[model samples]
Target: MAGKDRQITLRFLAEPADVNFGGKVHGGAVMKWIDLAAYACAAGWSGKYSITVYAGGIRFVEPIHVGNLVEVGAKVIYTGRTSMHIGIDVRAGDPKNAERHLTTHCIVIMVAVDDEGQPTQVPEWVPVTEADIKLRDSALRLMEMRKKIGAEMAAHVTPGG
Candidate 1:
């Protein structure tokens, strides 16, 4: 896979319409941005249309102001037969100062799909750099944790409840 296909970054200004009653960009808006970036990264890497299968571990570290410059970065850290694990980082800060800091982070799972929307196989991602290896390991750890969490949650549910 080409190096450029593994990542994507979106930069834009947070609009006033994105603000919440608390006068900061709404959490939902940030989530939308994250989804958009993740999709772009997944599609670029897989060379096929992709859809989000799961998104979790979203942490809003800091409030993003309406006028702040927002950057959402997404990278494909791991791949399954049909799924890509994307690591997304959302950062925002004053546009004038040109300084930015992390505001949110999450992991999104995207599945490549064929024209009929069936899951399609994607090229496997192999980590080459130290950062890439670290992120891939992190994704693997998260996947294991999610499985345990899912089993625990299922144990608590009752039939037809």
Candidate 2:
């Protein structure tokens, strides 16, 4: 499982059902795949069910056409006492040629949960490989940006009487 592995790659074909009116894969459909991939990655590392607390920085770089080979790469970039920040990149291309282009990318935060559905602690992630270290550093930068954004939102949110 991911809890022990910490990274996973999901590959499949883009079906026609995932296409939009413009004949390209729908954005919502792609997001669903991203969420599922992230969930799998988090659950693997946490050794328990996990819930997505946040999904951000989704960038759709190119349109995914029906019949293209799709690959969703997910990795646990950072972990907290009870949370894991997963980074995902979606790429699609010709399966026969084996060349893939980045179609979308995003970051998702998943929180491990116990049987009672409450948050639980996840094993810490220590970077070993150079790629892992680079991703961890990027995750740290994003975390800081998230904190700043949260603070700004909290200051503007009106309290209920």
Candidate 3:
């Protein structure tokens, strides 16, 4: 992986087909963009294929309107043996306007994969900037909360329930 490959960005216009019946962009469409951006960042950093294992705290803070210029930014904030923790920000605004407002944010975990599609080791990432350090620490702090939520969700799901 190149030194500067840890971050990836994508920008495009939110099309009419991406909207919900209410005329706002669908959350699913945003999530799809997020996933794509995450994959690109993870793959670039790992120098191999990567798959999303988990996406946490997807916050849809604002509704996006069609024709808005949507931008998705993905960066690897932390890394484990085979997983890269990516933070994604989705922003949008009028194409004619330069200013963009954040619409959503999320944290996604992607695992590097081998030819057999099994988890593979990825190059470790070390924090360089202050922002990277803070984001990495934030990811560490979320582990306990994630475990609790996972356990609670698991308990709610019985064999067929």
Q: Pick the candidate with the highest TM-score.
A: 3
| lDDT tens digits, residue span 1-161, model 3 | 43368898899999999989999999999999999999999989999899999998999999999999999999988999999999999999999989999999999999999999999998888998898899999998887789988898997787965
In model 1, the runs with Cα more than 4 Å from the true position are 1-4, 156-158
Query: Alpha carbon lDDT of residue 94, candidate 1?
Result: 93
Per-residue lDDT of 10 in model 1: 99
Mind sharing the TM-score for model 1? 0.93
Please provide TM-scores, in order, for all candidate models, with all chains considered together: 0.93, 0.92, 0.95
The better candidate by lDDT, 2 or 3, is 2
lDDT of each residue in 42-114, candidate 2, tens digit only? 9999999999999999999999999999999998999989999999999999888889999999999999999
- Predictions in order: lDDT: 0.94, 0.94, 0.92
- Write one digit per residue (lDDT tens) for candidate 1, span 23-121: 989999999999999999999999899999999999999999988999999999999999999999999999999789999999999999999999999
Ranking by TM-score: 3, 1, 2
